[model samples]
Target: MSETYHIPVLRDACLEGLNIRPDGTYVDVTFGGGGHSKALLERLDNKGRLYAFDQDAAAAEQAQKLATYPQFQFIQANFRYIGKFLRLHGVRQVDGILADLGVSSHQFDTAERGFSIRADAPLDMRMDTAAPLTAAEVLRTYSEAELHRILGMYGEVRNAKTLANALVRARQQAPIATVAQLKAVLEKHAPKHREFKYFAQVFQALRIVVNEEMGVLEEFLGQCASLIRPGGRLVVLSYHSLEDRPVKNLIQKGVLFGEPEKDVYGNFYKPFEALHRKPIEADETELAANPRARSAKLRVAVRTEDGVR
Candidate 1:
């Protein structure tokens, strides 16, 4: 893997959370740069197995570098289907599963990916190049209300409704097909001096909707409880609150939404228990080396016996 593909965030903390066993089976659902997968493989023995999943073709290409490792295998698909793919590989359960969510550094830095506000590229922020939806399509076809919801819910943009209306009006005049075109519309409404942050928020909203990230994450997490053996770990590194919330809920409440239901005995049922009350943040040392690590929040959970059912 190219060193610049991505720098794994909270690497040591994630490894420690996994508490790897040499002969155990493990999975890295977002094997972006294969940095975490490569590290996991190094700690495993011949009997151990590692299954990695990545929807991005670029990441799949990066996976080639680790193809020599007999213990490692890569699945070029979104992790929403993690259970289906793992079962096809004869893996019904694993000792640990690591999910590093959100866009990778390579995706953001690549000018053509349209993930970064810093560059002017086609509005194609599809994490999987093969995916049908693109940011451009979302902007061009989505209703103003649909746009408002995503902008507010996914990106937490303050003027989502206003912006959504503006987008609809602007697209009527001409298609907002590129980052530059979209930014031209955004510049009109963006708060002075905070234009960059505002642009990033809007981009994040569009990217999430285009990729169906939150929905995919919920599906993937739903499978995790059943796919991890009792005592196994689930380590997730989420970059934003939208990604972190479900992980927190699943670990704490054993459900994606709402509070955990109480059993007949009046005790709440939970599949996994959080290893820490608070999400772990990158240390000063790591932040100094990789500024991208600043927003990362690592959460680890252990599957309880209840998860096996």
Candidate 2:
């Protein structure tokens, strides 16, 4: 019932990074809490428009509660399908694109959402409630081998195999329904001193798979160069290495495919130009204010027309 603690990460930096124009069109790919979208709208003029997408129904409701802005339009859909969603509204070009990826504070603090390992709630980490695969279903249905791969590849858990085998074995005795039950299985496999961070990774890995985040990010970034008008900026705030690594690689080297290629002329031929060589880390001020921002890594890129290949 109280105000959610979304506290947009890199607020000033994101806005400045986008180089917001008074009458330009913009898109907030992840409109969690509508904090960034509202901020963007406030900076826009009557002619300006901001089209924000959030798959979560709760987030769309949050956007509805905001002070009415004529220039704001909220869409309830995944950003990966952004190309189709924007096209329906007859939108072709945007001045800037912003995405604040990963689970939000509201999702974590709210027990029913079951995102945080700290709380005991139903293992339903779907950002969009309509999403068919819930965390509980994943744990309850997945093979031990499949579970191990996700935990290892996504969460970077050290003993993923042990953890996966334990999950499947434990759930067989009783279906894993809540975060507490799942943690009980993972706790035995987790290290003694590093239990919290360790378990958090396990949960993070499950959440990422349930949401298909890596695939979603890939689709969203693939369209960015074409979506944004030339010279328009792309600002992203990724919370973990899994998310940041792709962003870093894409910004430095346009294509999200395999490794970069070398040419006879020695031209790198990257599609995007990095606004900053290094990722922007949260300052002590921001970290102290919101510990969630501690892991936030922001990368900005500008669209280039040169790399058509």
| Model 1: per-residue Cα lDDT over 1-309, one tens digit each | 565889999988999999999999999999999899999999999999999999999999999999999999999999999999998999999999999999999999999999998889999999999889999999999999999999999889999999999999999999999999999999999999999989989998998888989889999998998899999999999988888988998888878898777767678768898899999999899999899999999999998986422
| RMSD of candidates 1 onward, in order | 1.4, 1.8
- Write the residue-wise lDDT of candidate 2 on 182-256 in tens digits: 888877888999999998898889999999999999989888877888888999999999899888888887767
- Which pairs in model 1 have colliding backbones? none
TM-score for each of the candidates: 0.97, 0.95
Q: How accurate is candidate 2 locally (lDDT)?
A: 0.89
> What is the Cα-based lDDT of residue 18 in candidate 2?
95
Off by over 4 Å in 2: 1-5, 261-269
For model 2, which pairs clash?
Answer: none
